[model samples]
Target: MPAGSFTMGDSSGDRNRADGETPRHQVALSAFEIDATTVTNDDFARFVEATGCITEAESFGFSAVFHLAIDAPPEDVMGPATGTPWWSGVKGADWRHPGGRFTDLEGRGDHPVVHVSWNDAQAYCEWAGRRLPTEAEWEYAARGGIDGAKYPWGDQEVDEGGWRANIFQGEFPRRNTGEDGFPTTAPVRTFAPNGYGLWQSVGNVWEWCEDRFHPATYRRGTTAEKRTTVTDPVGPADGQARVMRGGSYLCHDSYCNRYRNSARSQNTPDSSMGNAGFRTVSRRGAER
Candidate 1:
């Protein structure tokens, strides 16, 4: 990606005010190299094999999986997560076994690796000599040079162009018709590339960024401080949760409609879920 500036948050009325996707501001970013696709199960498997790194999900003995995607036996299902009835904690859910003990990464090696936490993503980045893109960079790149657009492909509805991205098509939490050709996650490179040649920038799985989560980060006098363009802005200095962008395949307009370029979400550094994954970026402009 080349050095450029863009409006950071949601200005288009379609934002979730509670998620703090407001008070849109200007952000300037430097040239950086971001992966064209999110890290796949095969990609993470290589990292794990090379470094012998155990992900938080594996160490914790449980990870969150969508209710419909859980393939574990009744005994292995740890029950639904608090507040989110649609998500259940499974005993053996990890990147290698996305659903549970009954599921394996047999033919889904090309799909984005889920059940990864911010810390786990960091480990992979360290081993690969790369880093997660900052929230600003992620949004800028996600826009694919089309600033202020609702999505990476610009304001046409997600389903307007023949299921542009992978996301829940039917009713959420109860049924997914797979009208988008995927109910859980599609291949990392399943969608068309954006102007920058980046695929699946918004829908597929939420991609983690190198930023601490703060609802008011866009507020004046908060992080950026000034109203003018802030060059290479990172994020808040400290927070309990890390930022995650690009809503997952579970996103739907009837419910969690956060699949836009400016939508934001967060989770603890060690919390892993089946709908979250990440891509890496090289800070060095000369590196690819």
Candidate 2:
């Protein structure tokens, strides 16, 4: 992609826009190339085999697994998150064993690798000689040349015809109708690509970006101040969490309607969960 500009935040008029998404601003980015798909278990496995790297979740001894996906005994499963009880911190859960020891990536090698943290993603990027996309680059590529569209496909009517992306189709937490043909992570290429040939740009799994968390990064000049473009912008210089975009399978319109192209959220750099994964990008002049 060539250098270009686009709106980079949720619109104030959008009822679904959160307070953090305010002050929608223009962002200018340099040319870059991002993965058309999230990194898959097959992709990560090659990295691990080459580098002998262990993901943070594997080292920390746990990763957040959706309660509905847990197959182990209740006593063996780690407790749920403080506020979101639907997320269970399953022991032995990692990228290879997403639902804990009971689960494996047997026939699902093509699915997006979950249970990965920002640190883990960086490690893989380092090993693969690629890097995570910045939040701006991510949203820019996600928009697929469209301006401020709600989704990669520009269709707000989710699952109207059929499954466009992997996400909760029925009641969340308690039940997943699997109308999207998946209850957990679907194959990386399950959905049609965006205008830019990017698949699952709005859902399937939350993708980590190379940016620190800051709700106000896009807050900028008004009529009183000169307009400026945030050229090839990076995120906050310091923060406790890193940015995650494109929502996840667990997201639903009833709760987290964050599957929109402009939607974003954050997690600690070391935090890993079954619903999160990432892709890689290369600078325009860099080797892939």
Candidate 3:
């Protein structure tokens, strides 16, 4: 992707906006080369086979799975968390077994690898000689050369023949009607690419960025500062969780409407779930 500028977050009047996405400000970024799609199971498997590296989910022995994905008894499959029961901690649910003990990545080699924590993503990036995109760079690339466009496709309705992105349909958690032709993670590049040729930058799986999560990190600049754009701004210094941009398959207009380019989310660095994955970026000037 070439160097460009765009607003980093959502505006005040932006519908379905979250508190963290306030104080929309301009961000400038230099040219960088990002993965066309999130790291897939095949990509991660290659790294794992080469180094015998085990993921956080493998060490933890379990990761979060959507309730609908786990069909067995609660005692057999791990129980769900009290706060958000939509995500059930299913035993044997690592990146290899995305749904639970019953599921495996047999034919889904090209699908984005989920149940990967931020640390796992970092390790993968290091092995690939790349790094996770900074929050600014992620949003800039996601915008696809269209400044202030709601989505990577530039303000197109998501349900226009469901050609936009893979997201939850019918109902969330309980039932995914698969109206978008996907009840779970779609194969990377199932949809068309953005202007920058990046695939599923808005939806599919939420991507991890190299930034700490701060609800309101991009402060509203004083009049003078507002006129000036921030260049490659990193997130705040102090925060427990890292930032995750874009939304997951569970995102829907009825619930989480975070598929827009400016949307944001987060999770602990060690937290791995079925809904999250990541892409990597390499600086253009770096020797390949």
Candidate 4:
């Protein structure tokens, strides 16, 4: 367990944006243990073999596939491909089958599992004697140690003398040079761990947290000058979509840069796509 306080949100940097991560504020948290890495295919496979869990995407018979992977076929692929032609809704594209029919987790056992919805993640957590981290807990862990720093390692744009983290390294949508050494999700723990010894907290895949999305929730405060500092902030009690954090390999500066520690995004609890996956967290006293 690592204990520390940090000024949550962007800390005034070139990548910092206004709208969501505004009015950066200080937050303190007690020591807690987070997963060392995102849940990998091997990890999920173990859980499935032990508990016989079937993911929601698999039950639905279809899941979101990246445009590039979807379009790689010989043009005879059969499925309800997205009209956008970029994001194809391919059948059998669940966690086991990532890029539709042809793709499999065979050689990529260490890769983070995808196509997991909030409910699916919760189920896994429950089975593992753990739970999804709240948005506050997630952000606190992702912030590592540097107070208010933009990226996980610090305010520095690049990894220590190297391009760290898996993100789009070239033009978005059209071309990706794979300068980050990966086009899609890299193996879990491919990058260095944060101060808390947590890995892949900033990129790889967006993680689901225990919170609901509300644009106005950020503004609710005791007074106009200061917003209420919540203890173990659980976000709004009820809402349509749940919060997702840490962004994913799909994140790009030209499009979505939500991989930043303080950034927040959301999707329906029932919705599971290729870019979304999750990790589990357990309380200190909980049986492990």
Q: Is 1 or 3 the stronger prediction by TM-score?
A: 1
lDDT string, candidate 4, 1-288, tens digits: 555555665565533343356555555556666787889999899989999999898898877877765633444344444544556677777898888767888789999999999998888887887888877778888767666777778877744578778877677777778888888889987878888788889878999987787655555412355544544456777679888999888888878777788888888998888887887777553221
Task: Flag the better candidate by TM-score, 1 or 4.
Answer: 1
lDDT of prediction 1:
0.89
Instruction: Order candidates by TM-score, high to low.
Output: 1, 2, 3, 4
Count of residue pairs whose backbone atoms collide, per candidate: 0, 0, 0, 1
Q: Cα deviation in Å at residue 219, candidate 2?
A: 1.4
Task: Tell me the spans in candidate 3 whose CA falls farther than 4 Å from its real position.
Answer: 15-19, 71-74, 220-224, 283-288
Q: Report the error of model 2 at residue 185, Å.
A: 0.6
RMSD of each: 2.4, 2.4, 2.5, 3.2
Question: Which digits, one per residue and each the tens of the lDDT, describe model 2 over residues 190-228?
Answer: 878989889998878999999888776656332334355
Q: Quick one: best lDDT, which candidate?
A: 1
What would the TM-scores of all predictions be? 0.96, 0.94, 0.93, 0.89
**Which segments of model 1 are wrong by more than 4 Å?**
220-227, 285-288
Off by over 4 Å in 4: 13-19, 71-85, 225-228, 284-288
Q: What is the C-alpha lDDT of each candidate?
A: 0.89, 0.83, 0.83, 0.75
| Top TM-score model | 1
Instruction: Report the C-alpha lDDT of model 3 over 1-288, residue by residue, as the tens digit.
Output: 787777877742554444377677777778888999999999999999998989998998888888887744466566768888888888788888888877788999999999999999989988888988888889888888888788888787788866689888886667888888988899998888888889999778999999888776776331346767887677777889999988988898877888888888888999999989999999443222
Model 2 stretches astray by more than 4 angstroms = 12-19, 220-226, 283-288
